[model samples]
Target: MFKDSVVIVTGGAQGIGKGIVHAYARQGAKVVIADLNEGLGQQLEQDLLAKGYSVLFVHTDVTKEEEIVHLMQRAVEQYGTIHILINNAGKFQHKSPYDVTFEEWSDLLHTNLTSTFFCAREAAKVMRHNAKGGAIVSLASTRAEMSEPDTEAYTATKGGIVALTHALARSLGPDQITVNCISPGWIETGDYAALRPIDHAQHLSGRVGVPEDIAQACLYLTNPQNNFVTGINITVDGGMTKKMIYEE
Candidate 1:
């Protein structure tokens, strides 16, 4: 569905980001992998290229504005125009409010919240002018609404992203650009074989979430046919968020 389209995926080297990149590439999109991990990013770039897919690895630290600008410029330079942007570069560290220092708090905000704004701003500038406009999808978390212990910083950033999604969507709608957020719950990016039966039973879908779940959501939100569905947050969490969990 994304043939000949340029799609930029920030933090597209590993985990959920990697899954998004794979999804886009498989759909014939020119995938740009913007990430800090040179090894993983380059490897992914080469792997996809070997498989006859078009992909680029641009080393980018999303927390830095200049690097983000460079990444966007490189994307346009390489692909003519960017059609979709996936702001998925974020770090999640479990730390209590009292345990987190000022520096740590700032780092989390810049990584998760500020980076999203910067990337979206740069991408929207290009999208607004394109004949097809564009779409932006940010990776948020279920923690934005509910929280576990020692997750203040991560939760706060996610909540900020949720709020930012609608704001950007409303502002970008005039340009035919769609902005949306996906909040995934209990996504097991690690080895699934390590998980026990009860772990899967805890979820309403009878299994923990996977990165492909969010990847599909991104595709739907960015699809031109789904143009009317904007400024929304789709939670792909196996219905766990709706189920009541009472301590026994």
Candidate 2:
């Protein structure tokens, strides 16, 4: 569906992001993997290239704006211009609100929230010039609305992404750029074999989610025919946010 298009996935070297990279590459898009892990990033690049798909790994620390600038430049240089951008780069932090340092909180915001804005902005600059425009999807979390103990920092940034998605949608509407986000709940990036029955039963879908689940959602939101679905946060969880629980 993404034939000949240029797709950039931040944090594309591992886990959920890696799944997204594979999804786009398989659909015939020129995929750009942006992340700090040189070893994994290059490995993904080589793996995809071996399959005869166009892929490039750009070592990017999303927290750095200059590096973000370089990332977009490198992408365009490699494959004309960018068509889709996946803001999936982020880190997890779980600390009590009382103990979380200001530096730590600020750093998380820069990595998760600020980078989302700037990356979309930079990508939009190139995307606007195209007649067909482009699509951008940010990764939010179900924690944006619900909360667990000592998750203030991470939850705050996710809520910010949910709000930011619609705002950017309005701003970029004139340019024909569609902006949306996905809130994934309980996506197990580790050993699925280790999860017990209760884990699967916790979700309405009767199973825990995998990276490929979120990846398919990204593909749906970014598809050209789905431009009418912009400015929304699509929850990809197995109805976790809608379920109610009472402590025993």
TM-score versus the correct structure, for each prediction = 0.99, 0.99
Model 1 TM-score, 2 decimals: 0.99
What C-alpha lDDT does candidate 2 achieve relative to the native structure? 0.96
lDDT of 2 by residue, 12-93 (tens): 9999999999999999999999999999999999999999999999999999999999999999999999999999999999
Tens digits of per-residue lDDT for model 1 on 22-110? 99999999999999999999999999999999999999999999999999999999999899999999999897778899999999999
Tell me which residue pairs clash in candidate 1: none
Estimate every model's Cα lDDT from 0 to 1: 0.95, 0.96
- Which ranges of candidate 1 are over 4 A from the true structure? none
TM-score of predicted structure 2: 0.99
Best by lDDT: 2
